[model samples]
Target chain A: MQTVQTIITDLKDKPGALLPILHAVQNSLGYVPPEIVPTIAKALNLSRAEVHGVISFYHYFRDHAPGKKTVRICRAESCLAMGGKALESQIKTKLGIDYHETTEDGNYSLEAVYCLGNCACSPAIQIDNDVYGRVTAESFNEILTEQSA
Target chain B: MSITVYVPCDSSAVSLGANRVANAITQEAEKRGVEINVVRNGSRGMYWLEPMVEVATDNGRIAYGAVKTGDVASLFDANFLNGGTHALNLGLTEEIPYLKKQQRLTFARVGITDPVSVEDYVAHDGYRGLKNALSYSQAEIVKHVSDSGLRGRGGAAFPTGIKWNTVLNTPSEQKYIICNADEGDSGTFSDRMIMEGDPLVLIEGMTIAGLAVGATQGYIYLRIEYPHALEILNAAIANATAANYLGENIQGSGKTFHLEVRQGAGAYVCGEETALMESLEGKRGLVRFKPPLPAISGLFGKPTVVNNVISLASVPVILDKGGEFYRDFGMGRSRGTLPLQLAGNLKHAGLVELAFGATLREVLYDFGGGSATGKPIRAVQVGGPLGSYLPESQFDTPLDYEAFAAIWAVLGHGGIVAFDETVDMAQMAKYSMEFCVEESCGKCTPCRIGSTRGYEVMDEIVNKRDLDKNIPLLRSLCDTMLNGSLCAMGGMTPYPVLSALNHFPEDFGIKAA
Candidate 1:
């Protein structure tokens, strides 16, 4: 396994390498582990506070591992105009988990994203690497069920 | 002879099942023993017609849209390969009124070419600007841009020429050109469109900037939400590099320019130049105070030219067509076309690239066909989230910088998000402050603390607690944040809050005072 330290080593040569390193760590490990903060700080020659600050400042970086599936729902004005509020409620009800919560079964994790630049096809959602647009409550349920299966 | 079919590789198009539609078409063609050339093109900016497939016919390319996988077989059955009519048929693509009326200067080849094909890009006058630029002195190139009257498309409306001139004049051992692709605004996607559609234009634009400014290195600070764009951009970069359009000694000009794409973590504040630079440095995205402008000292304390994607992408055209050609399009000091993004409740939500001075009424009614919900549009928030919410009474306001300013509003980033009468202005006001709180860099007290206080006050007003007191408090807090904030993130947060309060007082449960 390529450890977080090794990932940091590969990216350390670049300018302003911390964000990329953190992104790499998250991509590889599913989240930036608290245990590796000190390691990253020492490797980058920055304070642990600095590393932690960078990690926490961006909403994309997660401190903990997500569930089997991570779903990001667009919460920006475009989505809001297209009944995104209803869709959010429906998703929460379906998974029994609110934003930033993982399902008890460890099958799903939900997060709110500002915009996905798919405003034309409003009420967009991203599940892992795939983005879906013009999502409805029924369609969302179908997508979740299909992904879970 | 194999018939050519065009399908969008645009991220938003893909999100709407353009990928699946493309796959189904290919599979259907193979199964039917028909030869077809499926070319992945970029979106036409008519997103409502997405998954919009085009067929090259003698009458010009014909379009079929809102396609589904199940419709693919039937499409072939109807002889769609030869521009056959079907239920989804939209006739000739260019003849479509929504796209035909608007001027497409910057996005001339966007949806018209294979984005990764350097040959196809060049065929459509892609490298002409770079070729023209190679012949000119750096000052001449800057002069041409200045004469074009191009302003920054990224909401600020700063003269593109003046900024380039400053960077050209600023002597530095290490100068940088940073293309701010961190388009975090909600209603805009033109940046993403241009990047994914005709990436070579942006590369050519950046290369021109490098040659003009004597910079050898450039970075595109792309937003994290655009994974699809990132993939397309990286591939395009590699293709350009392989073709010697990028890297050292580009096209035998003896000039060296290297370009790299850096991903931004999800932070709206990073769209601001100073904060973007700070974030690019691998630090917290904190907004820096002005004294040493980015043109003088930026990107590792070296003189850097930071421009928005649209601003940079528009350069190739300006260079190719001469500055006066572009300058002839618009009205007043706000010259050149504005690629206005019509989104939210608009019936025909898409990109409308037109010369400046198109009224809000023309955009909303003529181009957009009014609200999608068929209800009366209560408000339209122009220039992204920070822009003011305009009522119908203000619809006659021309989409000019000064015209918008005259109305106490801004034409920031050219994004117009419409909201129907059902929208609650109080809730929108609350979300504005809440978004500020969430995305604020915490560098200044006004934005950091004021946003939270504003949200609380809006909450109280919505909840009908201390309406008389909290209303005045919110206004005062907005004033302080507007005056004391370090950047536009704090300063412009008041635009939405106050506009909502002023325009639609009924939604806030208050009588129009």
Candidate 2:
């Protein structure tokens, strides 16, 4: 596994290197550690404040570690036009966690995304990189069970 | 006998279980001891029949659609490998009514070929435009586009030639061509389709822009939501580079252009050209005030040519078929076709690339097949999140940019999200403001603070608390955001809110104004 220093060292020279660096760190480690902020800032000749600001401003980045699986439900208008809200409530109840909350067992972390570009088949949700469509509450439970099994 | 089969790998098709269908077909073929070849192609945009399987036959590619894993065995038993009778069969892929009825200049090769195959792309007339562009001088190239009357399809509808012309005139040692692939609009997926389905076209388009404007480097700032598109684009880039369609000295022409894909961390505001540049620079996604437009001082303070995915993608066709030939398709100042995405509550939802001037009513009933619930489609939100919501009364309006503007509506990005009669306009209005608040980059006071206040006032309006006061207050706040916000993020947020409040006041507990 490439360490945080190596990721920063590799990407620091690219123009507008901050977002790409943060994405690389997050993608590999699942979260950007606050401790590495100073190191990243030093490599990029940016202040720790500037680096921290960039990390916090974008919704996709996170400073803390997430659960084993992160579930992002689309809450945009297209999803809402379908039964997304109802499905959202069912998932929250099933996992015992609301949006942005992690389950006690760290099995799941819930988040809301605006759109997954599956508008034609609305009420979409993405787990990691895989997006599912026309998902009802019942199907979601089945999908979750299948993935875990 | 070795038979060819196409299973869509387009992300939307995958979302609808295309992958499972693909796996089933392969496994079934092996089980039957039959020689078969499987091609993971892009979508046909007929999503209602997704998991749609096509077989290469004497009558062209026959389509079997909305196929499930359970149905795969039956299909093989029915001799579907030879395009035999099947309950799910939808006839020749090109003959589908929904697909054949409209123009498809920009999306010509999208669902028709292997997304990353350079040879397939060349066979389908992919690089003809770039090759034609290579022969012309930079000014002549710009004039061809200018004469084609291609406007930005990324919602702003700015003339593409004007933006390119400005960048061409500005002398700079370093110039950048940025393709805004950060398509964060809730109801739009045309950009995603082009990237995942025919990425080589975009590569060709960007390469042409680089050659025309004297820029050597180009970047596609794609949103992270499109992980599938990212994968396809990178693969296509590599394939194009290896084929000399991209990278330095293309086909030994001596002109060099390098392309890279930059992933955005999900900021809606970054769709704005200036904010996109700011985010690209590894800073907070904030809007920059423009006196020196992006064409003059952009991307590291050098001349930049920033265009939407559709605008750049359309360039190849304009060049391939002369500008006048391209200009002959649409109405008014809006030239060429727009890849209209029918989403939300619509039945048979998918992408329809049509010439401008089609009435919204014709689209709703003719292409859309009305609402999915079989009820009346009460509202249609054209464009993306910030676009205005038009009631059924306004359905007769043509889709021209100027025509839509006559009613204060915009054909923004050509994404039409329908809502059935059961939808509550008040709730939709509230979500619009809420979306603004969630995605605002907080660069200026009007957008950052105004959106927050707009959301609150909407909450008050929805709750019927101080209705008279709240309604007036919401409008005032919208005024502030419209005039004061630095970019469209803040400026356009009111389009939905006000359009909702004005068009469907009954839902807001008031009579229509």
lDDT (10s digit) by residue, model 2, range A1-149: 35887898898888888888888999899999999999888888889999999989999999999998899999998888887788889888988999889999998899999989999999899988888999998889888996788
Q: List the residue pairs that clash in candidate 1.
A: B155-B413
lDDT tens per residue, model 1, B1-513: 999999999988988889889999999999999999999999999988999999999889999998988899899999999988899999999999999999999999999999999989988888999999999999999999999999999999999999999999999989999999999999889999999999998999999999999999999999999998999999999999999999989999899999999999999999999999999999999999897999999999999999999999999999999999999999989999999999999899999999998999999999999999999998999988899999999999999999999988999988899999999999999999999999999999999999999999999989988888988999999999999999999999999999999988887888998
Instruction: Indicate the DockQ of the complex predicted as candidate 1.
Output: 0.83
Query: What lDDT would candidate 1 get against the real structure?
Result: 0.93
Two-chain complex of model 2, DockQ on C-alpha atoms against the true structure? 0.89
**Each model's number of backbone clashes?**
1, 2
Per-prediction TM-score to the true structure, in the order listed: 0.99, 0.99
